[model samples]
Target chain A: MWTWFYQLASPKWFYQFSNKLLPWFRAATFILFAAGLALGLLFSPLDYQQGNTVRILYIHVPAAFLSMFVYVLMALSGGIGFIWRIKMAHIVSVSCAPIGAIFTLLALITGAIWGKPTWGTYWVWDARLTSFLILLFLYLGFMALHNAFDDRKTADRAAAILALVGLVNIPIIHFSVEWWNSLHQGATISKFEKPSMDADMLKALLTMIVAFQVYFVTVLLQRVKAEILLREKLSGWVKKLVTNQ
Target chain B: MYFQSFKEFIEMGGHGFYVWLCYGVVLSGLVSYFIYSKQLAKRNQRNLIKFYKRMDARSQLNANNQLNANNEAQ
Candidate 1:
């Protein structure tokens, strides 16, 4: 099991696998996203109070979920790289940063938009919102710190350490509603128990989650490929690959 | 399905602009990434070719210098 895991840590293996997976992710993302959006926008029942504005939840919730999830993934991968000195884990962590940051921004913007009509304000310093904002800052901090180093290895290690240190925020972001007086609603779509939503709404939300997952995979593969090409520029295989292209 | 025309779909019950704005941002991010990756590959390829060309020129120069030294020694 450990050997298999180590094999996957090989950059060549990752590069080859990512090449095979990219197109599949792209195709699945298209199909799933179309289905998800259609179901969410067209089929789901309108909220009794929020009306069609509730539709934004499909995108908002998924982005919010992914932002936190991706951070945890980054932190974990970074930790593994730190412990084992696996460069691929470092690459994975670095690749995750900008993508996670983008999702964080999406969540913040969409959440604020959702709040304006629902909470009668566009901004709030509520716990859930504030923690998530902190998360965005953490992502930005990691990226900035990673780039500031003149040496790439130093950058990777420094950024990995930042990611590991920032891991505490993930839980705080998740449970902020439970911990404090937050206007933001608690988990609506992610709860494991029977969802509070009606069937159509639940389906729409779940569909959106799947769509977002596909989108993440698609983007991650593309980023990983770019990282590999950049890092392996002088390798014989890369030379052949480039010349053939 | 809710809206009758394309305009009404854009309207999205007064939330159209906000919703569309989110989609627009996501699209732009993806597009920018695609463009960035392509440009990066092109730059790397160009740099690699430049490096090989310089290396080849240096080797050729050394070879000519070595031949001239040999002739001088003779």
Candidate 2:
């Protein structure tokens, strides 16, 4: 395990490994998105009360889930890098910010559009919404702090500290719907029992969720590869990637 | 497959606008990022080549200058 960890931590190994893995990830991303979208848009049944607006969940739910999932991954990587002084981990943590921010924006905008149709309003100060907005701000703040320092090591440490501090918000975002009386519905996909929705709807949502997860991995690997190249540009092996291919 | 026609599918039981808008915005965002990230990776590689070439050129110039200095001293 330590051998694997060290191998993964090596920027050169990660760049080559990701280069090999990307073709497979890209193929899976394409197939999964196609399947998920087909299942979501055409086969999934509508919510009797909300009508077609519920179909928005096919995108909204996955984007929202990715937004939070990416945040945790980012902060955790940042923390790992901070603790161990792992440069690759710092690269990963930094790569996650923009992608996570984009997903958060997607979630917020789609949620607002869905809200307008279902709840008759676009914006609300409810707990879930507010906490999630803070999440977006946190991502933006991480990037801002990271870029503020001219030295990469100083920037990584400072940004990692901010990310670790912001970990408090993740649980708050998860439980905000329940902790406060809010318009947003409590999450239904508990582990022990079948979800409260129709099987077809559940299937569509699950498929879309997996698709988005795979997509996140695909993009994350790409971004991390770019970052590795940028950081390792002066190193001998990175120059081979340029001169050879 | 659920709806009777393309037009009906597009209408999506009168909530079509929200559903399609969400998908469109989200899809476009994902697609643009996909393209942008790939381009960035390629651009980084290009930058690496440019960086090495500039370094190589500077070294060659330095070597030439050293040779001139030696010739002048001799």
Clashes of each: 0, 0
lDDT (CA) per prediction: 0.83, 0.92
lDDT of candidate 1 at residue B44, scale 0 to 100? 66
lDDT of 1 by residue, A1-245 (tens): 59866678878788888777877888888788889888987888878888778888888988988998899999999888888898888888998999899889988888887787788898888899889999999999999999999998889889999999999998898889999989988887554687888898998899888888778877876777778777776677877777676
Query: Which sections of candidate 1 miss by over 4 Å?
Result: A1-4, B1-8, B30-43, B51-74
Listed models, DockQ each: 0.39, 0.78
Query: What value does the lDDT take at residue A85 in candidate 1?
Result: 90
What TM-score does the A-chain of candidate 2 achieve? Answer: 0.97
Local accuracy of candidate 2 as per-residue lDDT tens digits, B6-35: 998999988888888999999999999998
The TM-scores of all predictions, comma-separated, are 0.88, 0.96
Model 2: residues with Cα > 4 Å off, grouped in runs: B64-74
For model 1 the TM-score comes to 0.88
